[model samples]
Target: MTDPVRVVLVDDHVLFRTGLEVVLGADPRVEVVGQAADGVAAVEVARAARPDIVILDLRLPGCSGLECCRRIRDELPDTQVLVLTASDAEDDLVAALRAGAGGYLVKDGDPAELVEAVLGLREGRSIVPPDLAARALTDLARFDRQAAAGPIGQLTPREREVLALVALGLRNREIAARLFIAENTAKNHVQRVLTKLGMSSRAEAAAFAVRAGLLSPS
Candidate 1:
């Protein structure tokens, strides 16, 4: 049998944290390994627990949640972060992604989504609330279109090609088939594109591509 996924909860609210523990605990596939009431203890508990995922809140005390997220990711490269907060602002989402969070969800969603988010992160999928997605993309594209000028120049010709295909919503396999390259090579190219662009995920990179006219605007 597969081992249960270990998770750490980092939120300041006692009632909320306990409620989350209960919800996640009901799923046999997940195990709640630790809890932190603030940003400072967040890092310390996460390091000690060494969980597979850390569900953090953006509004934190003792230190900002962004700093905690960044520190934890820097200190533990293997552990993924999932931001669970009440804020649905695009800036918070962008900042969280920059700090290495793998998923972002607002507090008002169904509890089942939280479970799904945990599973999705474990399976290497990026998660964001469905409602905020379109707005986030268009706004991100507008903002990044300007910022991408300097960073976009950093990408090689081949990497630029890869970014365009990625913007077209092609998966690594499809990109490989289209370019007559190995799937792993396509994946590597995608990663290099994101890294050079200083973007955290394919979503952000794709938005940049759309604004730059690399992909036809839909």
Candidate 2:
């Protein structure tokens, strides 16, 4: 049998963290190794536990999730960081991605999807909401035009579709439904778009789309 995907969760909300632990623990493919209530504790726990994936919250007491992600990326290069948070603000999402988050998930995401994201990370895939992915591409193009030029204009046709929806503020699952794809597949596209554009967040991508006239004011 394949080894379970080891995971450590870091969030300030005790009830939410506990609930997540219970939910994730029930998955035979996943193993909940440890939990931390704050970013400082999360870093320590992550180091000690050395789980394959770290599920982190963007907001936390003492250090913040972005800082924690940066630390984890720098120190534990082998451990993937997945951000699970309530905040969908473009800035927060981009910041976390730029800081080296392997995946980004909203708090209201289905438990099954969350489990899939953890597993996907182990497979060397990145997971992000579809809307965010679109935005990342749009932003990358804009950043390229403003920063220089050349290859930024070469986004694939699918990336353009994703960016248009991102400017509209749709979520990942919503995008998946619209495109007739699994949520995980949609996330994979978004991660690929972000990485290609050298962007870290959806907000940055949205702004770029607007400037490029890919999305008009609603």
lDDT of each: 0.84, 0.77
Q: Write the per-residue lDDT of candidate 2 for residues 1-218, one digit (tens) a residue.
A: 99999999998888998999998999999999999999899999999999999999988999999999888877897788999999877667667767878778899889999998888767655577877665655444545455432323756778777766655656677678888988887777766766677665454455555556676644
Q: After superposing candidate 1 on the true structure, give the runs of residues whose Cα lies further than 4 Å from its correct spot.
A: 144-146, 156-187, 200-218
Models, CA RMSD each: 3.1, 7.4
In Å, residue 94's CA in model 1 sits off its true spot by 1.8
TM-score of each: 0.81, 0.68
Q: Model 1: number of clashes? A: 0
Show model 2 residue runs off by greater than 4 Å: 136-218
Q: Write the per-residue lDDT of candidate 1 for residues 1-218, one digit (tens) a residue.
A: 88888999999999999999999999999999999999999999999999999999999999988899888988987798999999998888877877888778999999999998898777555677656755666666656556667777898889989999876657788888999999999989988888888766665576567667676655
| Pairs clashing within candidate 1 | none
Checking candidate 2 for backbone clashes, the offending pairs are 94-201, 134-162, 134-163, 135-205
